[model samples]
Target: MADWASLPAELVRRIAHCLLYSNDLDCYMDFRAVCPNWRSATDDPNNSTKLRFRPFRWIVVDEVSETHSRLLINTFSGRVIRKDLPLLSKYFVVAATLGGFFVLANKEPPHPAVVLTPFTGHMIRYKAAVPSYVDISGAALSGPFTGNCYEQYKAVPDSDSFALDFDDEEWGRTFVSMRLAVASGMCAFDNWQTTVAVPPLPLSLVPKISYLMRLYAIDPDKMFSDKPVTAFADLPGTGDANHLFLVASDDGEVFAIIKLQQHLKVFWLDNDNRSEEVEPVKSIGDRAIFIGYRRCISVSANKFLSIVANSAYYVKSTDSSLAIYKYDLEEEKEERVSEAIDSLNQGRLSFAKPPFTIVQLLSSYTVNVRESQLLEMEKLKRQQLPSVPVVRGH
Candidate 1:
């Protein structure tokens, strides 16, 4: 009989590619672990840019356990990868996660912050003032360093000394203060850092005018430019009860997600015209969105078939514990998925060290898969391995 383990290296690579594309992180890892040759054939996700995939692995703090260790869990596969951090005891508060790096800040005074990649154990320290909040867009990090508010309203100084009425066009055009509301998240597309902000509320005394949202894009390199800032799109603002979230789809489309009391409203940013507008979206095709303080991510449901498409997965906090729920966009309904025991009711558990940030794991990385169907695929593949034909030497 032919040796099944003796499959050609090229064939093994093909198998690894299939597993990677399936979004089965656990299976991919298993494939590499089969032999030294297979391991060498597969690319390391951390170093390779070609094997990028949707983030399925989450870096979360395991507060429920007595060890207080940091864990990397694959939501699809249920595999838990744990890492210990002696520094976590002193710097427990996670400020942000950007470009696959975690920014951890010390809780006490003389506070210092460090950027770390949990999987790689790479660390960099920053001695500057710790930001109240931090956001990562590609390689750039942005947050309020000097101010206390993430979103603030500042009056525009009237240097001309003209008592222009709010109704005047000049007041509307020049004096209209820039009302900046820092977005819940940041996304990068075509080298532009994009975020959504609430446009300055209309100054008219009349009640007919409505609040509108502005989409802002900046080139991180230039910092300042003479041209008027590009307003990528305009979104119709709902009442005060609604909150805005920005997320990027796997295909690089930007979406504005508004969270109400019970349901979520999603909008697609359409920039075909000079005046960009947000179109209300009832469905997200084959994608599912995960939003919380930890990270905001959108993954393809087709690749990870176990997770339902056009749904929103979110975390909610109760008196004693924190629970995760899936909100169906098509059905306009919500169902609970998992609940973690946390007596503090802080709901502070994140995929990474900092409390609120996004983590994007490339396709080359492996995550645990718990679903029976996914496991069945691997079992079937092994069963189908061709038996070697018997040959007798004369």
Candidate 2:
């Protein structure tokens, strides 16, 4: 009965959070545009405790053939958007989140650096180092002109050691020559200023982890000058690494799926010490397959939460072969299992095929692996399987 504008700021902000965390994704975006007060309440950090409640839409990308490709972005409820990134030349997706912004790159050569953010519908082109190959993966940025990378494939993007100045609104290209430090897998903190860059160096130099994954936690600030430190965690070698997603809790702990051999390993890492505590999330991975393509989409209902991922399924017999899966941790246990784990394992399983996936390490330049293979063979002895187990059931 009273005017909404006359209400206390705290009350209005609380209401905004409720709206943002609601199941309706459309209204969240709409409310952000309703008035400056609403937008401020939703985006402001003081009111951001509600940000972790939103759902995430995974964007799945897969190659249909040598030339033709399919790009899909959607939520788990069948809401989808698709595009084709033809292999005629080169195509790459740079930085993305569960939110609507997707920074995509094109590999046309001679003029190779282009970034596209789907939400603002803004596309910007940068001067990529010429005579240099296009390693689009190095092109991770929080916003326009505020990220770093090594000259394509020559190095890995490190959050703990790279330079970033997000508020300057000017692009710096000096990292085109920096050496590699972090691993191939990096994490983008909930706050853009604190993106995590992984090490590209070998695993032997670090602790003994069977599989590799990178996690970056950026301190919330406009100037991207802080260097995120490095940390390591163990994962299952036979599980799908790509299925691993990163999410940070408001309490300063980071969590993700370890995807172990027999169960899903859920780990909580201390943001300060990088010390880890592991717990079994479920026995879900044993039943699921990580085939098809995966992508991350950002949508808001209350506060901005990065929890959605979109996946496209490849089924030969159905017209509805293409599907989307959305996940939110705040949902009921039954829903998380049904949407996140169960759906991924739906197709037929074959042992001859890869139980897990191996994404070809992408680099800006072409490196001959023949020499690396020769070195590997010289360094390690070959081991063969002891025997094959007979299947008792089909």
Candidate 3:
């Protein structure tokens, strides 16, 4: 046991990689807990060559009655770390996700953005407000930028999408807002430092209102540059014309599934562009792809996206459950015949599967709701009558 403890931290991490490559998450997490060196190895990017772990840390924001921002951390041991969540307010904590390394805001009323990493329970605080250009209904960190989904109104519909660069130190309200609508069906991923927004339909192919459907190709850095931006393009008509398709790719690619008339069709972005109409890459079965809950969605570079769907097909709304699907990508064959043959021998097929094998029984966590409605209620009362509108005389 002393010999095991004496091994260099790097070598232990190598051992962890060997274990992880063999699909040994249990052993890997165990190795991370073996000592301080083992745990530190988990954050080293160089070790990521063999295996990549999600960069962000997730924490459950308990809806306690605390006035200040705080974080509840689990050490993968039973130990928990609690600290202030920067400018976290009681109301905001209820609607946050634990996907990324840090959480920032895109709402009004400027405050210092909150940044935390659960491992150390240490934080970096910035005094800035959420940019006005982008609205964050829900956001997850894809690389250094925050990929967000936002609604235009109070009604149940798709929200406009955009990404904000959280790494910027200036916090000058600079952000890139992509006008992609994933009000209902959309998938997203942060890979290769780019945010890929795929429409539910093969948007690039539709000719009329193609601009509306074409995949939105945006780089938040570029969008935030000092340049006037204007462009328009139409989507090509797919196998059908009425269905919308939205998709997310783990490796910076976008896939779209659209319903034309009543037939469901699938398409992919041949090249990254929101204005070009590409052809169909595949056709899904007659069954439509299932999109999850209003706010319960996440995309990971590991080639899977999670959605909150109903447990039983015919179950009532109250019986719905969350499901996680690992949507795999189609590997490309090399030009070399030997490479092609090697690829064929590997038998790597593109498909989707569930990663959360145990919790096929899990459901959406209840979103704690608080009311700022009292202010509105009072305003409504003041507006009523006011002496019967002065009898149309004032």
Highest lDDT among the candidates is held by which one? 1
Q: Write down the TM-score of every candidate.
A: 0.48, 0.36, 0.41
Number of residue pairs clashing in candidate 2, backbone atoms closer than 3 angstroms, sequence gap of 3 or more or interchain: 33
Q: Write the per-residue lDDT of candidate 3 for residues 309-340, one digit (tens) a residue.
A: 11110001111221222222122111110100
TM-score of 3: 0.41
Q: Could you tell me the lDDT of residue 366 within candidate 2?
A: 10
**Of models 1 and 2, which has the larger TM-score?**
1
What's the ranking of the predictions by TM-score, best on top? 1, 3, 2
Write model 1 residue lDDT over 187-268, tens digit each, in one string.
2222323322111122221111112233322221121111111111112341232444455553445566665556777876
Higher-ranked by TM-score: 1 or 3: 1
lDDT of each: 0.42, 0.28, 0.31
Q: Candidate 2: which stretches are off by over 4 Å?
A: 1-29, 32-100, 105-109, 129-252, 255-264, 271-394
**TM value for model 2:** 0.36
| Candidate 2: tens digits of C-alpha lDDT, residues 1-394 | 6565455667767766665443234445554554446644455465553334333333333321233233333322333444344322343444333233344444443423344444333555545421222222333332111223322321122222223234222112222111111111222322222321111222122211212233322111211111110011123341222233232222223334432222234443333432233333422211121221121112222221222222111111112221112222223121211111112122533211222211110000011011111223323433343557988986
Candidates in descending lDDT order:
1, 3, 2
Q: Candidate 2: what lDDT?
A: 0.28
